[model samples]
Target: MAKSDESTVLDSGPFYHGTKAALQIGDFLTAGFRSNYRPEIVMNHIYFTALVDGAGLAAALASGDGDEHVYIVEPTGPFENDPNVTDKKFPGNPTRSYRSQAPVKIVGEVTDWTRLTPEQRQQWRERLAALNADPNAQIIN
Candidate 1:
């Protein structure tokens, strides 16, 4: 019997947008309470959800109230570059630099609560009151 010389290889390239930025509230409930001065009233509320498309990404940044706390959601991806190599002079040679894309910028801020309707304000107040009364309200994972 004789041995055969055969091998397999792979190629890699940049395909997607790389990085994104997000703003997280250090203390959401505390900030809301402090702003409204009403433990039973929800003042600052922010929520964020993200989805990816073919070549672009979309995010929803919303606030329960017109408070000063706003939600920010950004895009993110793997930081490491591909390992498969091509265009090499030799087996153990550096081909091209392995570089990854950078994060995109996503900024947001709470403007004013005055824009909220009376019904919306009342809804927020009720939600806050419920949370404040429930000991398990802090459980968010």
Candidate 2:
């Protein structure tokens, strides 16, 4: 990985990752929040970080994050927390807490989908065409 003077990316392991708005640069600096410790709720796991795919991440950002850097993070072992916890914040039932064993990093900045390059647009179009061709693919508005 190319190391910039600002920061460097570190690999944890084959795990899930999530994206959250950089509420502020301090957002990434702060430790992750877990649901298990909440007094009102039954404790599940100690260290939980939410993980989502590109589409899910986009939906999450649209629901809240906005124009901010999305912190992509993954967790390691200590499988104490339930990684599949349902998030009440957004529809479609996206997972909330994933277990993170390593420090999180600023992966990329979020921007409008129209900002995609022609190459990216073409690739997405091809992928969409393939999905549309699949009889089992559900077309939702």
Candidate 3:
């Protein structure tokens, strides 16, 4: 319901960030880490989504042995539609994904969302491995 500097209504959300990092409330999520999907490149923006399930998927797919975590996040500054999914993978922003160079403050944690089955998790890992092996696969960072 709030307007951004550009005057567009911001997507009021209980946004979430998913990862395997063990973080407590009030921690900040920032960019510059290697991409979860494409670990070769450092990310310029930290990504989050309005959908809890989407965040859950991100945590499940994250590369780590630590337990998956989905944190309720609040943007500290401006954010924009995630170009990776909005333009290249899907039209518009149905995924409700966004990215920001600014940090996201962790306000809470989500623990009730569905978790991927072991079989499903393995499938995702295999798929990501195949994509990593591809010489031309790209993520529209």
All candidates: TM-score: 0.27, 0.28, 0.88
Considering only N, C-alpha and C atoms within 3 Å, which residue pairs clash in candidate 2?
45-80, 45-81, 49-98, 50-98, 75-99, 75-100, 75-101, 76-101
Q: For residues 1-141, what per-residue lDDT tens digits would candidate 3 score against the true structure?
A: 222433224478989999999998999999899998988899999999999989999999988889999999999988887877775667677888888888999999999898999999899899989988998878766
Candidate 1 lDDT over residue span 1-141, tens digit each: 111113212213222211122344342211132222133444332212221221121111122332233233232322221222212323431332221233322343332223345676477667767766777544221
User: Best candidate per TM-score, number?
Assistant: 3
Q: Which stretches of candidate 2 lie over 4 Å from their true place?
A: 1-20, 23-70, 74-97, 110-141
Question: With candidate 2 superimposed using the best TM-score fit, by how many Å does residue 50's alpha carbon deviate from the native?
Answer: 11
When summed lDDT is taken over every stretch of 10 residues in candidate 2, the lowest stretch is 1-10
TM-score of 2: 0.28
Q: Which ten residues in a row have the lowest lDDT in candidate 3?
A: 1-10
By lDDT, is 1 or 3 better? 3
Tell me the tens digit of each residue's lDDT in model 2 across 9-72: 2222233333333443323322433221122233233232333343233334222435423344
For model 2, how big is the CA root-mean-square deviation? 13.5
